[model samples]
Structure formats: C-alpha cells, structure tokens
Target: MIHSTININNNNGNNDNNNNNNNNEIEEINTLDSLSNALKSHITFQILKDTFNEYSKLIKYGNFVSLKHITTGKYLTTDDKKYLTGSRGQIVFSTDALPEANAIWKINYPFGSQPKANNEIVSYGDTISLQNKLGKMLWAYPNYKSPTSGHVEVSCYSMNQYNNWMIEPNISNISTKKNSNEEKRYLKSEDKIVIWCIELVEH
Candidate 1:
C-alpha cells in the first residue's frame, strides 16, 4: 500500500475514575483532531507528492536485474553495464529475483552541458540533478550489493562520441567497474530513456 492507515482506540476507565478517564479521552480526541487538520494542509500534500514522485522515479529506471540483451540474448552477471534504450517495459530478463518495477518510472537525466572534472559547470536547483543522477547510477547494481564498500564514480559526457562534453544542465555519465556482461556498444535509438514495468521471472 502507498500509505499506512492510522487507528485510534478508546478505553474505559475504572468505575471510581470514570469521570477523570472521560476528560482524558476528550483531550486525546482534541489532539487527534489537531493532527488531522495539520495533515490536511497543502504543504503536507506537496511533501507527500514529492516523496512519492522521487520513489516512483527511482523504481522506474533503476531495475538492476539480470538483463538479457535484445540482440545477442545473452545473460549478464553483476558488475556489467549495458546501454539500454526504450521504456523499462520493453526490457526483459531471463532470471528471477528482480526488483519491483513501476509504470511511471522515467529516467531523468540532464544532458545540456557538463565538464570533465567532478565540479558543477551549471547549477539546476542546487544538487537536485546530482541526487537524481546518483539515484539512477545506483540502479546500475542490485540493492543486495554494497554501495559504500567500494568506489563508484559516475561522470557525464556530451554524446555517444564521449568527446564533446555537454554543459551543466545536460548531464550524462558512465558507471565505473560494472560487472556488465553485454554492451550494446551504441547509443539508444530515442533521445530520452524511460523505465516501465515488465513481467518478472523468479529463478
């Protein structure tokens, strides 16, 4: 479920203390009402939307599974990177143990301009894109793997040539030291990449 439900229960006090217990119950009800009203504010909705959107986005383009190449149909082990295109729905794998997928998971990346060094040449809302880029890069591996244990450096480039670097807003990078088995060796056919839900195979 997207959210958990809240529950409240009432308790009856002893006969000798019935009056006092009733007063306590009233106070509890007032507190609950205040909390409910506070949660109804627009700010609350925005926070919920933003959090859900980030999670949805992460799951979409971030399914790091035992992917089977469309052309070669070969299976890859961990630490491999394959340049993928099309929605996540279009990609299929041979093994089971896949992470949960979502329909609205879109791969968000900045491709406007960037630099060779790890410095920011352009700023788009202060590290939001950087966080987003890092999230996408995290998908290069399964959740069972360790992130802090090793070094993962992702850098952005201009285009398929890997020569001309894009400006700040436009960011692209490669996942270093991937256990990638099959490499497409070509850029995706479409300009934008998307992730969608597909059938899972449990092995």
Candidate 2:
C-alpha cells in the first residue's frame, strides 16, 4: 500500500487561490496540474549512475525523504515565498534555517505510471516525483533563471529533466553505520543525498 495520500486542497483543481494572493507566489508558478509521468526526454546522464562510489540506501515510492544541498549544507526547501522576477514563479531555495516542515519531501511514482507495489524501492535509472508538505510537487523551470542565483530555477513545480536523480550517500552523525551484507549498500534515515539534474542538448 502507498505509505500516505497527500490531499492538496487546490480549489478542487482550480486556481482560485490565485486571488488569495496571500504571499504564496510559489504555488501559482505551477501550471502542471497533472502529475502524470509527462517527461519525454530520456535520462541525459545515463552513464553517471554506474559510479558505485557511495553506498546509499534504496529509496522507495511514497517515502518521505529530505534532500540536503551538498555544498551549502542546507535542505532543499520551499514555501509561500515569491521571486521578485523571472518566471514570476514561487521561490524554491535552500536554507540552513530552523523549522523542518518546509524541507521535508515525499517521493512519489509519477502519477499514471505507478509501480505495481507501493513498497518498491528506488533503483538506478528510476525517475520519481517529489512533493512537499504544502502539497506542491517539486518542479523546475529549465528555460528560466533565478533573479538571485541566475541558475535553473527549481521549486515545488513539475515535470522537466528530473532527468533521473543519482543518490549520493552521507554517513556522518550516525552513531552506527551498519551494512548487513558486504555486497549491498542500504540507505538509511537522515542520510545525506545529492540530486543531479543534467540537461542534454540534441544536435
């Protein structure tokens, strides 16, 4: 069974909340109301996942996981904050701040192409969806740049080159690091992970 069902009260699928303008400019940037596996591009970096460098645990569908930005040591987060310009999108930023709610995300199978079993763990080459507490799925604006960072804008948006994420394991702060089988690497809770999204250009 699916671990949990997220109830997004999006005006019964209407953008009526747009009028609320409660400083939640982030949610309005998403026009992808449908959460199906709409990404048509193949994994642009299929050659990279073969690097068995770090032993990471397998993430399963419907798993609530936290993704921390490696360099900044901050959690990938989003909220009611808005960007002053660019895509007019809601802001998606990394923060080393308190209040853990916004930093937590639930991993989901793409809407229509769900797995036969909900407990199926993530493996190499698996494409997944990430949804936040506010019920907004993780999204990115590939064609746009952030007004501040001037990089690809990633927010609780929708389908793009999720390209497929490579899980990089973090083993610090855990009192004990245990691997039952020498041949297997199991990712555990609070494990630090890196998500890489590379854009491919077809020539």
Candidate 3:
C-alpha cells in the first residue's frame, strides 16, 4: 500500500483532527475529495528478492493479484466512487489488513496495445495495468499533484499510458539488488517488485 495524503484542512478536517488527537484510531476515508487513509496504499505483492527463486515464477496475463504493500502488509484497493475533483477519476487507495475483496486487481497489457500471442507470462519490465473489480484500472496522473507529497497523483482511471506501469525486480526499498543482466524473468505473486512511471509503486 502507498500513502494518500490527507490535509488537516480538507473536508475531512474533523476526522484528521481526531487522527492526530487519537493515537490509536483514525478514519478510513478513501476518496479524492476526502482522502484520509488510516489503512494502506495501492500496492503489489512484494517479497524480498534475496529469496526470490524460492517462490513460483508464474504471474501470467489475466491473473488476479492482490498487491500487498511490502512494508505495511496492506492490500491495494479502490472503489467506483468518483473523485469530486476536476478529473472526476475513480478513487484508488490501499486497504485491507490482509488481501480482501477490495484488494483484488486483474493483471493485463494495455487495452489496445499489441497483445501477447504466445506468451502469457508477465516478464520483468513489462508495461501492464491493474484493474479492480469495479472495472477501473490503476492510474497515475503526472499532471496532477498529490495533496500530500506534492508528487504525481495516483488513482484509478482508464486504459491509457498513465495507467500503464513498468515493473521491475530488486529495486530499492523492495530489494537491495537489481538483476539487470537478467533480460526478462517471469514475475510471480508475492515477489518483491517495483512499479514505476509516474510513481505508482509500493516498494
């Protein structure tokens, strides 16, 4: 899971205030208009590569993967609720203390891009999209700034480049080593991974 910053002065000001005052409690709001997450972020299952080969390397196209935040152990989730902001995008956030219904994400290539005819295996550095049960895909808006980090805003939108992500292994925070020599290795569920490009990552 990732961080969706909640400004103390936003519409959920009262909840944010309570989160600050209450040490052991916080609201779980996950909409753009009132982004307050006490749970998790949009993440992919990641296990440290030091023990990568111990797991099955078979994450293929059309697989339903619940990306678990390697650090927080949270699951990436979203809903059909639209953002009240100008983009009116679907809300993307992290939740589920464990992988649950809201955390399930479908894996696939870009909607109109060249399809993989023979290989269904997802390779390292492949550009892919993660779709939720509501049919919205994970999106990162480079044009919009996040309310918290002043970086690109990550949400669930459509099947465009913004939604396409390049995945790699052994990246920082996720792993300390990078196997650049390994031209293309099959990616498996729970394999510590990094999704970059406009910063849609959970490393």
Candidate 4:
C-alpha cells in the first residue's frame, strides 16, 4: 500500500461583500505524510499492477482497451518499447522497469518547481499492464520540494460505454522525502521534482 500527508488552511477570501457567506470554511490540503498514507490505505500499488498488465497486453497483441487517441478514436500501441534508446526516448514500458511492478510507490526525480492546481506537467508518459483490475487509472504526484508534499489521482473508464462517458474517481497522494546535505544532489534534497501516477480503472 501507498500513502501521503497534507495540511489544511483557511481560505484567504474574506471580504465585506459576502460577510454572511457561511461557506467560507478553509479547504483541506494533504501534507506529504498524509498524502502518502491515503494512497497506501487505498491499495494503490495493487491498482498500478493491474494497469501495467493491461498496457503490456496492448504491446504484445496490439490493441487499445481504454482511452482513444483523442483524435483517432482508435487503438494505438507503438513498437518503440522493444528498441528503446537513450534518455527521453519514445514511450515505452517493461515489467522489470523501475518503480517495479506492484511498486507500492515511487518518487520522481529531476522535477523542478511546483505548479498551481490544474497545472500538472507530464512527468512520465509510460504504460502499465492491468489485465483485470477493479480500478481505472491510479497515479501519484510527488511533491516538488520537502515540507510541501506530492499527490496521486485515480480514475476509471469503460470501453463498452460511450466514448465520452467515462467516469473518473481520482485521489491525490502527496508525500515528501526527507534527505541530508551529504546525500547525492538528486537524493540529498527531494525538493527538485514532483512524481505522479495515473491508473485507468475498468468499471
């Protein structure tokens, strides 16, 4: 299981116009620790395992079981996985890859700066194999820095249903990694990047 932590703060919108607005309660933000715990509690690792299984199948047999290309509405699985090269190569996946299968959780590196909500950058464009899983898509987004935290979101989709009628039930998992000065630059301070995951569930 994976988990995360977060902090809650009061909304900063206090004005005279809506003085009587009773819905001004502060929003709850998960701390790094809280985010981590939540993901673990939800059995997120199991979800990833399933996604990878499905992804691998497409590569092996050539098919699209979920989302369309948003343009082609057709199945598309590139053969790049077989002959992957240097860094930032074409999209690919391998069972023996890092953040191993059923990887419980993984932290991303080289991720710099945190963007406001709705500003999630593509961390990794990879695939998973989830032959028969309950959940849709489950992903984790590590914090950009320490004390700030990271997040994870999950969603579900169906191939038999209408193309645009997919339902997404997502949960963000945020966790912060603590490090020391002597550790490697990437390992020393876990504040330069954010790690996130996506789990496509079948309903």
**Count of clashes, each model:** 23, 5, 8, 58
Whole-model lDDT values for every prediction: 0.29, 0.53, 0.59, 0.27
Model 4, residue 158: what's the lDDT? Answer: 23
Per-residue lDDT for 24-48 in model 4, tens only? 4343434766555545556566698
Off by over 4 Å in 1: 1-33, 41-76, 79-94, 98-203
* Reference-based lDDT, residue 25, model 1: 33
Better of 1 and 2 by lDDT: 2
lDDT of 3 by residue, 1-203 (tens): 43354323235335545555533434445574344222223222233443464433457677677776666666767766766663567666666553444567778786568867533767777778877655777888777765655677778765555577777786432322247764456675557775321111221
Give me the candidate number with maximum TM-score. 3
At residue 67, give the lDDT of candidate 4: 28
Which residue ranges in model 4 land beyond 4 Å of their true spot? 1-65, 76-80, 88-201
* Ordering by lDDT: 3, 2, 1, 4
Candidate 4 lDDT trough over 10 residues, lowest sum: 184-193
Q: After superposition, how far is residue 87 of candidate 3 from its true place, in Å?
A: 2.1
Listed in order, each prediction's TM-score against the native is 0.20, 0.51, 0.56, 0.15
Task: Residues 100-156, candidate 1: write the lDDT tens digits.
Answer: 331111122333445333321122222212111112322222222223233222222
Q: Cα lDDT of model 3 overall?
A: 0.59
Estimate candidate 4's alpha-carbon lDDT, on a 0 to 1 scale. Answer: 0.27
